[model samples]
Target: MTDIVMEAKNVYKTYGGSSKKADLKLVEAVKDVSLQIRKGDIKLIFGPSGSGKSTFLRCLAMLDIPDKGEIYLGDECLTKPGVDLNKARARIGFVFQNIYLFRHLTALGNVELALRRVLKLPKEEARERALAALTEVRVTDCANKYPAQMSGGQAQRVGIARAIVRNPDIILLDEPTSALDPELTGEVIDTLRDLAKEGTTMLIVSHEMPFARDVAEEMIFYDEGKIVETGPPSVFFNAPSTDRAKKFMDRIIKRTTRE
Candidate 1:
């Protein structure tokens, strides 16, 4: 039995070398990035835009294949060949920045689809679980509403419900609130806070400093395709060990304060 829910070892990813342009350089979006998340851990990754945080997250979820290194969900190596990736992915929930709800389906339908299709739950069971998940995210009122009918916050909450309905071992959230309007951000944050209180194991790529400071057990500072610094939230809020992290924190804090 292992306490580690997920682990990444020397994970590497690149892009753009396949372009026809001769001068197009290979961009290393994730360079030898390694991370470990234990049960009930809430770790936050924050850095400059286009720094490959999202790429690393996608690799962890096995949504994007890594060029080098290994990803482990518990003891199972996801990057290995012949693995049932679809089965593995079903155990790992992923919430994207853009709320990718199915426009044709209502909120409940979006959540129930995975249960019925992937998990193969009975129709009545799927509906019950979907409604429960929506209630957990405080979006039960949006159950019958289509994506186009809900507010941004409600839609994102539905996306979260879709992610969590399967009761995956861990949830990987990429900039969960970044796409929402500033005022709407709080509702999503509140849902996340409730999830945190429930001890959900989460690895989130977010810049929501206030929420991070309040809920994250560890904060990782990533930049230039590598993890530059990592520590408890106090280390980043007070004084980061690395100059790069310090400068980044200063810029982010200043911007947050201004907003």
Candidate 2:
């Protein structure tokens, strides 16, 4: 088996170029970007707000189809014409920034939905697995609670449970803690830290510098829809090679310290 769990090659995605709006210019959200995540790799991508880190992540999961380039999940090239994206996505877990849990379902129900529906597991087995996932994320106490009843931290942990219930090859998180209150962020970050301890392969777009420094195997500095630099956390913290990365780190670190 290949060491690479996921790979993106020359991926490009654009929007509004052909739109009829006279004032709208084309937006190249992901421009010729390529990345690879090997087994048990924890890579963090960080940059300015509108730099397209989330877009690139979506393209990696096939949630958004790229206009050009190839995305590979292990040996399967997901960009191929006849590939089954649903199956491909099943092996990949995605945690959104906003924590989109189903309002109607209890936390367990939300997590079990995929195992029961998509994976076609039996009822009892799905429930057991769902409970186990909730326990793993430290959200088992919220299993019977609906999204509306849970706190932001609890809801996000449930969201994580839902994603990991399927035992995906890797988890792609888009600023998982950004939507929560500052006080609530710690619980979520702790859960992620636990996952890191267990060697989960994750590609996270997060600005949590402490978490990144502690958990990430490599840090990628992305900007303007392109990767400006990539290196270990120590390299970025001490000295980034590129001027852009250095400047960005200075600004971000100052802001972080202020906060």
Candidate 3:
């Protein structure tokens, strides 16, 4: 009924508080964020550390529960203050900053396990799907190779393949290229672009402004657990429309100039 592939409304999260210290206030990670991503969007969540950008992305992906808010994937309510957690989670695929493949399992095995175990897919079907996903990521040659034998970029691509194998409605990437060299980063970025073009909605948390500029259809800047600005990359980068976003972009500019 809607074009939105994902939605997060009035979401909130916090940390660093214990029952022993009721007076110890929670460090808010996300504050009443309400955002939407249309189907097939490649959206960027970019901001300085502790700005709550990462937390928002995680909550959108269903990896982290929102303390208060509602999330919807398509017509389905995944989270509504409290709701069907399993169904909503099933529609999301999460990728982390570090690739955490099972060392004992070969690349193929790692991808296959998820499909077989979680999805309850038959062996043959799981193998076919896993191989195709790996090929899409251009890591088919390394399918039989163990994670230890692969480079960081290769491992990350495999991580992506694992994510796509589930064929989830949304892919959540947490700094996918933060560890790779420039050349390797290019490979992964290209793979990501292909997925975006294919209409797999994705929300990425990244500090790579150049890549974000190239890949994102929309950009959101967060500050102090709040979304400061959301707009197309052209506008967000060129004209931030807010003091906080302007200051954030200034820092990005400085970082780029120094590097």
Per-residue lDDT for 1-259 in model 2, tens only? 6799999999999877555657577888899999999999999999999999999999999999999999999999999999999999999999999989889999999999999889999999999999999999998899999999999999999999998999999999999999998889999999999998988999999999988888899999999889989999999999999999999899988998998
Candidate 3's displacement at residue 1, Å, is 2.0
lDDT of 3 by residue, 183-226 (tens): 89988899998997788889898877887788788988878999
TM-score of each: 0.98, 0.98, 0.92
Question: Candidates ranked by lDDT, best first?
Answer: 1, 2, 3
What stretches of model 1 exceed 4 Å from their correct place?
Answer: 18-21
Which TM-score value belongs to model 3?
A: 0.92
Each model's backbone clash number: 0, 0, 0
Error of model 2, residue 17, in angstroms: 1.2
Q: Give the alpha carbon lDDT tens digit for every residue of 1-259 in model 1.
A: 8899999999999998765557677889999999999999999999999999999999999999999999999999999999999999999999999989999999999999999999999999999999999999999999999999999999999999998999999999999999888989999999999999999999999999999999999999999999999999999999999999999999999999999
What TM-score would you give candidate 2 relative to the actual structure? 0.98
Q: lDDT for every model?
A: 0.96, 0.94, 0.86
Off by over 4 Å in 3: 21-25, 80-84
As a whole number from 0 to 100, the lDDT of residue 114 in candidate 3 is: 82
| lDDT minimum window of 10 residues, candidate 3 | 80-89
- At residue 184, give the lDDT of candidate 1: 93
